[model samples]
Target: MRVKPLYFFTILLLFSSLNNAYAFCGFYVAKASSDLFNQSSQVVMVRDGSRNIVTMSSDFKGNVNEFAMVMPVPTVLKREQIHVTDNKIIEHLDSYSAPRLVEYFDENPCSPPVMYKMMPMAAPAMKSDSATVKKRARSLGVTIEAQYTVGEYDIMLLSAQQSGGLLTWLTEQGYKLPQGADAVVGSYLKQKMKFFVAKVNLKKFNQSGYTRLRPIQIAYDYSRFMLPIRLGTVNSQGQQELFIYALSRQGRIETTNYRTVKLPSEIEIPSYIKTQNKFADFYRDMFRTQVKKQNNKAVFLEYAWDMNWCDPCAADPLSNKELRELGVFWVNEASNKPQISQRRRPPQQGQNVYLSRLHVRYDRHNFPEDLLFQNTANRENFQGRYIIRHAWKGTEQCNAANQYFKSLTKRQNQRAKNLSNLTGWNINDIQKTMQIPQRSASSSNEDMWWKDLWSQ
Candidate 1:
């Protein structure tokens, strides 16, 4: 959907029931949608040295005739430099990087199972105007450098000498900008950036026989590695969600302007989070809580790993052909090697590509500046992973079992606290939901130490 005032960048279930009980291994119950937050957008950027390839996709629900896109770029894109890619790749990338809910059943304190099984379940256009708009555009120093029809989109490369003129020209031409958008546009104009504007070609769109818009991909060789998000914030739709997936030949990509903190992962949470189908709720609350904790100034790193493989994989790595489509020109297209599959080991070396997923909840106040990014040599693997350790269900009792039962209560209590801490939920409510009892001098028969040992 549109993440900005106008339509802007908007941008999967696997069943492998039984899996080896190992680190990062468990059944993925549910995943939270980026749509969980309002005004959300997704962008996939692939970088190698000075070459940058950016793909923009959105779920614009407006009339196809009204769909349009306006973005800033360091250089003008040529016909060859611009392309349209399948939207499925973006979805695959999202699934590969999304935060996951994993559940691990507790082995009986007395006897552990050798194996286990887990089941899995699953842009609008611009306005129109005539020659009078073009004359005004020229007087306003807004020049349309080039125009082409790429796929179902009618694209234009525009260079403007001033922001007010450009904004006026755009307005006359039917592209509406937010009240203060001229300031942001001026900033980009001062940087010698060009505006890449697009609208749907109704005839081409119909002839293409597609249901919706495919992501637009653009490649350019420029030294500035950054994203201009200020325009998106000018409209001020409260806070917006931006998920950026960066693919690089070197290593992890991180925001240089804002603190890039890894989201809390590998933490234990209450079991009911899965049983009650509240994984989405838990994730959304926890994310908001984390944003608050950071004063909403930090960019959260949700996933960072070699693109060649993933452990406790959310989804398979993009195939070579798919990677090429994303503008990873360095990959050997002729290689016959098999595409990376779901695996339980550390990422295999030699893919020469690493992916870093950065999430931000931003508004004009906390994030005044557009995102500035840098690629790092740090290839350490990371993912937003939460755990659910099911309590051992058994009747037989032994010395180990007795201790296990005692520790289990403490563990469950700690889980409740964790949920509270991560999500900002009330501790009492969390405990009540998890059935954690308060410690007291007067206890019920069920609380006695000998109760389970002596009884069947």
Candidate 2:
């Protein structure tokens, strides 16, 4: 039997906007670079069995007329299978799974240990178009299989027999095919992948009266669970940052072709970082450090948790309606609630929703192939949680208080070292910045003076 070509579409838009996007499991600070080449691209992939739904949000910042996208899909999508969704849903998902910082205060060590039982914490949360005269497309060996105007996007399903022909046809039609894209396009063509191309319909966009472009959602069924990032890397500037939010019925989703490493998390850092509003910088630097440690060849898992609950939620868990809107087909409207047994009560509203946040900084040299993924049975919860422990500030003269003060100095020094190791910041500079007093060598000797005197 002949295999059918997977229809993929590319949006020809410069993804360069800064709208408080989320990266993997953390919010991409608005202050980060918003340039298309510098900013991050966000993708939400929902997989159940062989069905896959993808929602892509671009940060395109240029003339709307120049905006276009080309995506490779596994199968041709019908009008019903394609929809334009509000950007807020993507933002909500980002916020729900984002890496979070939780603050804890240390109680007075001198106080009697209150046998207070700890209560459990509650948990929280593409298109294209076509056109053309028959002669040019035919000469280029590009065929327009279908066309539709979905929402503000003019979409087209195209099949090209040759990459050179497709390139010529795209250029002839005024689509700016990036240099060095021909090889990537040729590779996809050899695999019989179809292209879905889309551009913003100015009239529709103006009529819709939306200031920014919304995300595009597409649904299809194919055995391959992968994302094509090679196109985005072609003729690109430095490394490109991509955030993938993978939702699946199974546990966490990870990259199959590359090593999927979890980001450093649940570490106690200096409390001053919170007051200094340096969490964003800290995360950025720490992420860079991890990428460097991995030799820039691994995908970092920022967060992996079930959708039912969160320890300290970054944002409220997405409702069933929101998940459905985001193209989670398995969510049943009537039975959206979790299954309850006579022995146990359900924890949250939704059931069997697992989200994996994968962040990757990629370049052509490091990521030569598209990303392949596999859903695993490992359901262990993980989050990029940074803790801030406020030191006790009591002046009590009890024996416990005295020991606490002595240990406090050691703890603070360790915190400084942790910060320096995670961010590659100078240890002395970090100490200076945090106003931490440097420990003197003489003070260390003073603590062991008896031992030193005996040895002499």
Candidate 3:
């Protein structure tokens, strides 16, 4: 109660400095604040540029005290998925194909059960913002082993008997394969399987027409990962040889590309590219090649916002010029341009005269001026069919569409004559077959399940 003013003031100053200390008393920065390191459990704490201000008592030390490094281990450094640019992602993605199918191998002549599965029905296609995921196939199950991109080189083994019998299985499952298609599928499978068995027996068949490959297991091999690795086939000699791709040190199941061309099975790939650099340059060149404007090729471009403000809607037109350019004629509209209509004027009261002297005149006006018509001459139509996308107000529009398609078969016949050799096919049938289903004109939206049945 009787303390001096100076003594009290000094004590207050000391307490204030203690409470306002910058951080923990010691200057050594913390290595880690918690147990989680590379695992999904992420740790984020305050750091002053150089180090974290993490504090721990002596009791908090154990296996849970795993220190997190700034960067990941060298092995897992490769990003699990690839990084693509904005423009390249959208443009190039559409052009990619699943490299090939998966392969199945056997040991002791089918003693080991051969797991043969296909991915045609694995899952709905992948949907992404930058690109459309056409998932030629999908991994049915997940394990510690992750899946790889479809187009890589890999091998498989199957019982010759099983592969041969699969033709019958395709029929029982209600797949309607054309005679020519069945022949191609069968022959391809048989040849591959035959080479496999031939190598196992070490029987040297005619190596003249045959590309001689000394049978040896590839040291670097990739995993199947549930992809539809090209199902290989056996030959008449009951033998098969498969080319396997080992996963890279970076964990990617990669294949030397077409330019760098590697085949999982004994496929007679025609040589086009000469060197590995040529192979690496192949895709980049391809990306450049596609951007080049080809007068012959016409694509069905779907713009997101222009068609309708709806999310991810395809732009369909009463008449799309691109389709017409490809010789796909859209039934012409009634008139290319709209015209002003003439109307009758109101009759004047108590005005009577001879027929020639009548005061009635036609009241007509030109079409309304709008931005749509602002661009060009009135004789021609608008540059685009600008409207709310999919604006089918009534069944009348749908009925018109139905009627147009009803005669589409007949048009393809006449068009087949005029279609010329532009598409490289003699007729639309081949192109129809070539189309990657669901994108075809004849592809039905009403019942795709039935169409899927027919497609098989």
Alpha-carbon local distance difference test for all models: 0.71, 0.70, 0.18
Which residue window of length 10 is worst by lDDT in model 3? 6-15
TM-score of each: 0.84, 0.85, 0.15
lDDT for 144 in candidate 2 is 80
- In terms of lDDT, the best-performing candidate is 1
Worst 10 residues of 1 by lDDT: 21-30
TM-score of 3: 0.15
What is the per-residue lDDT of model 2 for residues 177-250, given as tens digits with 9 covering 90 to 100? 66677987788778777777877899999999988877888876666677777777776656877788898888
Error of 3 at 304 (Å): 31
RMSD of each: 9.9, 8.3, 35.9
Candidate 1 lDDT over 1-456, as tens digits, reads 233223443110011223210000000000012132234566778877667788876655555676667766656678998899898888788877777766677777787573332212100001005467567778889988888999999888788999988888777666656667778678768867778788789999999998978888887666566776676666655887777788988789888889999999989899898788887778788889999999999999999988777666666777777889888888878643444444535444466878998888888899887677888899888988887787777888888888787677777878988999999999999888887766621253445767678656
Model 3, 335-409: lDDT tens per residue? 222112121122242111100000000001111110010001111111101111111122334555565544444
> Which candidate, 1 or 3, has the higher lDDT?
1
Clashes of 2: 37
Give me the candidate number with maximum TM-score. 2
